[model samples]
Target: MEIFWRIFDTLILAGGFVYIFIRYGIPFFDNRKKGIELSLKKAAEYEKEAEKLYEQAMDVLKEVKSEVENIKKEALKETETERNNIIKDAETAAEKISGNYINQAKSEIDKQKKQLFDEALNMSFKFMQDIMQREMTSEVYGKINDSFLKLQEEAFDRRSNK
Candidate 1:
């Protein structure tokens, strides 16, 4: 009976120690687990913040690309407009030059025509005066004059018929 009593008492003491160890040990480890979980949560928050910053950077890059394209388009449009203006100005200048050349050619042709007309009239007047002077100083001056007058009348009548 004494031996049984001693064994029972030792068992009870051992069970009590086990119970204390289980309860207090579990709470202490739970505090460490909570700290680890808080660290993990902070890390996830930082990851989310980094993702937001990356998204903002991407958006800024897109805006820069759009602005560059707009500037290029504007530059091309302005260059095209300037080119068209240059072409128009060149065309107008060429037209004016052509018009000036045409007018000069017309003026030259008119001057040549007037010169030819004056020469023809002067030649005809000289030929007719020579014939009249030769006929007036003949041996039979009156008869020669009368005959020349008759020939002149016949030439005038032929010209009128034509």
Candidate 2:
């Protein structure tokens, strides 16, 4: 009879616990499920925003890369232009210097030629005078002087007529 009563009491307690869990635990679990869903939705939104930022950064990086290439091309072109100008200027300077050197050389050669001609003429004149002095006596010189004076007078008269 006692064992029967204990079994009955245990059954009663088990029934009460099942009723409480069904009434309270179900609502608690449902609330927790809704909270988890809300958190997952927020996480998805944050992930989308992060993806959009990454795309924008990539676009900016591409533009910056293209701009850097353009700048490098311009710099290379400018450098090439400067190099050509330097070469042209150097060539012009070299030509001018070469022309000046040639002119100086020609002037020096002409000056030497003139000096040689003058010296040769002076030498010839001295030789002729020495020969004339050695061959001619004083009587012959006096006769040559008289003849030269006559020839000068005749040349002067002919010039006055013309």
Candidate 3:
């Protein structure tokens, strides 16, 4: 009777376990597996999206770097142009100043030459007037008349000797 009771109890416990597994455990496990699979799919999609975003960011960074290099080159070119323009302007200004200085010096030299000529002319005129006045005096005239008389006497003497 004891062994019969043990077997009977064991059968009842096994039947209850089977019933519970069929009623709730099967549905619960199936839903959990589907949820895990959906999560895995979502994770794969997110990884692909993240990879595309990273590639796009790298491309944009490269474009930005290229733009920055272009800007730097342009700035250097403009700076060089400005430097050349400044040098040209300075050279032009220096040439103009030099030309003006030369012109002014030439003009001054001409003016001084004219002034010296006029002063010399005035002195010459004054000397000529003084000498003419002295020559017009009676003493200088008598001297000139004596020189001509001597010349005539020498000429007559030379003719008589010949």
Candidate 4:
């Protein structure tokens, strides 16, 4: 009789515990599982979105890099062009300066030649006067004076015509 009562009490207790677990624990665990599944879904969506953003950023980076390279090349070309222009301008200026110097030198040479010719003419005239004073008579002097006057008039007329 004691064993039978003990077995009956144990069965009753076990049945109540099972009924309570089925009524409450299973639903709670199911709801918890649903929440965990929803969290996993959201994490997957976020991962996909992050990958898309990364790809877009990479594309943008590529374009920016290409643009930077193009800008660098254009700047180098402009710099080279400007350098060439400067060299050409410098060469032109040097040529102009040299041309001016050559013209000035030619003019100086012509002026010096005119001055030397004038000096020689004056020296010859003075030498002729000294010789005439030392060696010539009055009649010879008169004749020489007449011829000299005629030569002087002819020279003056030719100079005026030129």
Per-model CA lDDT versus the true structure:
0.92, 0.95, 0.95, 0.95
lDDT by residue for model 3 over 1-162, one digit each (tens)?
A: 999989999988988998898888888889889999999999999999999999999999999999999999999999999999999999999999999999999999999999999999999999999988877888878998999999999999999999
Stretches of candidate 1 exceeding 4 Å from the true structure: 1-47, 135-162
Residue 160 of model 4, lDDT score = 100
Model 3 pairs in collision? none
Model 2 lDDT per residue over 21-50, tens place: 789888888989999999999999999999
Estimate candidate 4's alpha-carbon lDDT, on a 0 to 1 scale. 0.95
State how far residue 63 of model 3 sits from its true place (Å): 2.2
**Winner by TM-score:** 2
Question: Each model's number of backbone clashes?
Answer: 0, 0, 0, 0
Report the lDDT tens digits of candidate 4 across residue range 40-133: 9999999999999999999999999999999999999999999999999999999999999999999999999999999999999999989878
Candidate 3, residue 93: lDDT: 100
Lowest summed lDDT across 10 adjacent residues in model 2 is found at 17-26
Comparing candidate 1 with candidate 3, which one achieves the higher lDDT?
3
> Per-residue lDDT for 25-58 in model 1, tens only?
7787899899889999999999999999999999
TM-score of 2: 0.66
TM-score, each model? 0.51, 0.66, 0.54, 0.62
Cα error of candidate 3 at position 158, Å: 28
Superpose all Cα atoms of candidate 3 onto the true structure and report the RMSD in Å to 1 decimal. Answer: 9.1
User: Candidate 2 or 4, higher TM-score?
Assistant: 2
